[model samples]
Target: MITSEVIWLTGASTGIGRSLAIKLASCGNTVIASARNQQALEQLAAEYNNIIPLAFDVTRQDSIELMQQQLSNYSGHLDRVIVNAGTCEYLDIDTPDWDMMRRVMTVNYFGAINTVAAAIPLLEASPRPHMIAIVSLATLAPFPRAEAYGSSKAAMQYFFDSLRIDLVSKNIDVTVINPGFVKTPLTDKNNFSMPFLMSSEQAAERMVKAIAARPRQFDFPRRLKWLLKVLGFIRALWNKIIAS
Candidate 1:
């Protein structure tokens, strides 16, 4: 029985974030959606009275501050902050450009950190504050050409895990969501096969349920989760298997 809670969702312009925003808002939560795409955000707001658009680039600290200001206009504490905003870029071994890694890290790592930092104060104001980050399942096992994407998500996994420990006494709960291949715009660009790919709606449903449980970690699709765990324990085997 998840009650209506104030939620701040990033990367809500499309894909998983957009679906999650709609799901949460429809369930009676006051959802504030953020992204650089104003038109998309506007469309989301138009669909639901509870969905408010807060457009900003997550990469900019000033933009995060401005979003915080806009949030103040709502005059309510956020029970949950979902930092779902991220970017993925597979590395081209032939080209071997560090810029590719930088692009992924800037959005996937630094951008998420900035959003959390700005939201912390507002989250602290709530009686039950929860923070969620949508990371990648690629962190569980090394994949070919995912050098940049994997490293960024791995960093985020570490960051959120550490934050969870530090915020324990403060009563601020943090959950790290590791999603397997989902059929989102982000994954649509992948040239390789994405096993057990779920739809955005399915991913959103799973995420919302997991967040309701407020677990320290949430990995979707039981079979995929088991496979990653087994592979994780046998790194050498996985390296050979994936590299093959």
Candidate 2:
């Protein structure tokens, strides 16, 4: 029932990005799916002829430039760009891999910037271009060991929020999507409990619905969002809970 459009989706090889690619393609969209794993992207594209696999690492300039060339040659325009490429690394204060901060920021924050840089010209060519990125609810409330991951998403949220203002003149809409816990390869690595964890399919369905609305921001699962909001409002209570 969704209208067909051209969409470029990052992190298409796994997790929520992969799920979103499938859902979008099923809805009749032509999806350019990107990821580090060429084989996985190829397999995903095989399942859906509408999908075109473009393999590259988000953190590397050379990789991003190569994909930019591919985009230029493949299509003159992109109706939407979905940046779901990111990595999460928890910080262990006691024995922290200080470099993990750099690694996470490089992909989650700077990587998204690189994607937008490549896609902006294409987006401008479309009649109604939309930019979307998958951020995390972790930014709403500080969680133990999430120093690195949460900060990256927080940066992403602000970047796009500001970018939305600048792109309005170009008629390009920017949407920042904040999702709570979802079962995926990335969250599978989490050692702590993830409240209200939902299936990636469910998350994708919600996202697609929100995308149709073209909201400037979309936060899923109202209950979890409220819970985080409440925690964020009470620093003392949040501090005590996480300290234990």
- What lDDT does each candidate get? 0.89, 0.91
Best by lDDT: 2
Specify the highest-TM-score model's number: 2
Worst 10 residues of 2 by lDDT: 60-69
Clash list (residue pairs), candidate 2: none
In model 1, what are the clashing residue pairs, if there are any? none
After superposition, the stretches of candidate 2 with alpha carbons farther than 4 Å from their true spots are none
Question: lDDT tens string, model 2, 112-201?
Answer: 999998899899999999999899888999888888899999999999999999998999999999999999998999888888999999
Count of residue pairs whose backbone atoms collide, per candidate? 0, 0
CA displacement after TM-score superposition, residue 33 of candidate 1 (Å): 0.3
